[model samples]
Target: MEQKVFAFLMFSGQADEAMKLYVSAFEDAGIVSAKYYPQSEPGAKPKVLHAIFSIKGQQVMCIDNQLSDSHPHAFTPALSLFVNCDSEAEINEVFAKLAEDGKVLMPLSPSPVSTLFGWLEDKYGVSWQLNLPAR
Candidate 1:
């Protein structure tokens, strides 16, 4: 058996949409595999049961949580996916894309730790931290 750990995001009903957006936002990112919920019940909306995707060589899993309403907890900035960008331009571009229809926690600007850094929550409420390491 393969024992591995990865970030698993639970979405209400937007797992597939979020996966597509992520694949488009980052280079070398794509969905590896996805399984959909069986349409056993009438009027049941198809949703992602499980999915594995890669972003910049990092694997992340996502699912459409059936119990999302029961679990009121949500993704928070306290635990954000941090991306270390190679260039200021890359960081800026990524920040712009992520900020679309989203709330910016921190504007992309020069910081003491990095030449450029920003924090934002995507439309799906997933928090991200984009940073360009200080030279």
Candidate 2:
């Protein structure tokens, strides 16, 4: 038997926003399901409890982490969502959208392995690698 695996992202009450951005940015993408936290106290803001969304058919799970400021863990560039673009135009468009208000680790340019390749961390601190594979 084979086990299914998917990327899970923890957000500081930004999971909903991130999911909306991702689904809008990628084609054939949408939220599959979402669960929100019930307001437990007066004037408490409801947060995303869990959400499963798909980007071009790849499913990713996200949740809001209501942790204290002293929490040591955070999203890092070490793990990234690698996108294999079908064309230069697609890569450029997606890259630009993702780079908005985000840090670009490597500018999109031709490389030995790909005609267009770049790395960036989005506003939500999620790293992504865009690449146009060799024809």
Candidate 3:
């Protein structure tokens, strides 16, 4: 089946940093495309305007808040990105990288429903769930 929906992430001004961290944490991830604001642009910070990144081939869209943006909305733990890891080593590696300067809601350890599971909110305020499916 073809993918029709994609996860979209919004950051106040950390879109680029978050994208970099995510891409670096996952082995099969990379920034597909990114548009950034020029310093000359009025009232616009020199930051990511829009970006499309892929994690394990799943396309995710993200953007930094615009100049006219007024909402004080910030990323909440209510929503999180769930990653299914291929192995124990993969989960540990990915989790360790993501956990840097981040909050760990759930320690990486054996869980009731999975062999290994962890939940965290990254330094940029994005939440993520890393899991190794039961074998």
Candidate 4:
């Protein structure tokens, strides 16, 4: 059996906003399911304890503000999302849109392996590695 990749994100009380933004950005994005604390469970806070959303046909799970300020940071460069793109136009559109108000760690240009490639951190603080795979 082959192992699958699923992204689990922890936000500082912005999971709902992030999900809304990402869902609007991706064509087929949708919530598979979600549960709100306290409203659906007893004695819980009103934070997003667990939720799943699909992006571009891929599923990504997330949580929000579940930990205190003492919680250790878990995000890293090694865990960035890898977007497999099919065309330069599509890549440019996504890369540009995501780079708005965000830092572009790597500029979009031709590489030895890709004609369109770049690394960017979106305004929401999520990192994305965009690339147009060889046709």
lDDT of each: 0.87, 0.88, 0.89, 0.77
Candidate maximizing TM-score = 3
Q: lDDT of model 1 at residue 50?
A: 98
- As for model 2, its CA RMSD to the true structure in angstroms is 2.3
Ranking by lDDT: 3, 2, 1, 4
Per-residue CA lDDT of model 2 for 23-105, tens digit only, reads 88877789999999887888765578999998877889998887725573578999999989888888898899999999999
TM-score (all chains, Cα) for each model:
0.87, 0.89, 0.90, 0.79
Clash pairs detected, candidate 2: none
Candidate 3 to truth, TM: 0.90
List all candidate RMSDs to the true structure.
2.6, 2.3, 2.5, 3.8
Top-lDDT candidate index: 3
TM-score of 2: 0.89
Tens digits of per-residue lDDT, candidate 4, 1-135, equal 332878998887677777777777655679887776666667544577789888767888888865647784545566678887777877888788878887898988888898778998887688989888755
Q: Model 1 over residues 24-109: C-alpha lDDT tens digits?
A: 88877899999999878887666999999988788899999888888755778788888898887777777888889999999988
TM-score of 1: 0.87
lDDT of 2 at 50: 92
Candidate 4 deviant stretches above 4 angstroms: 1-4, 39-46, 72-74
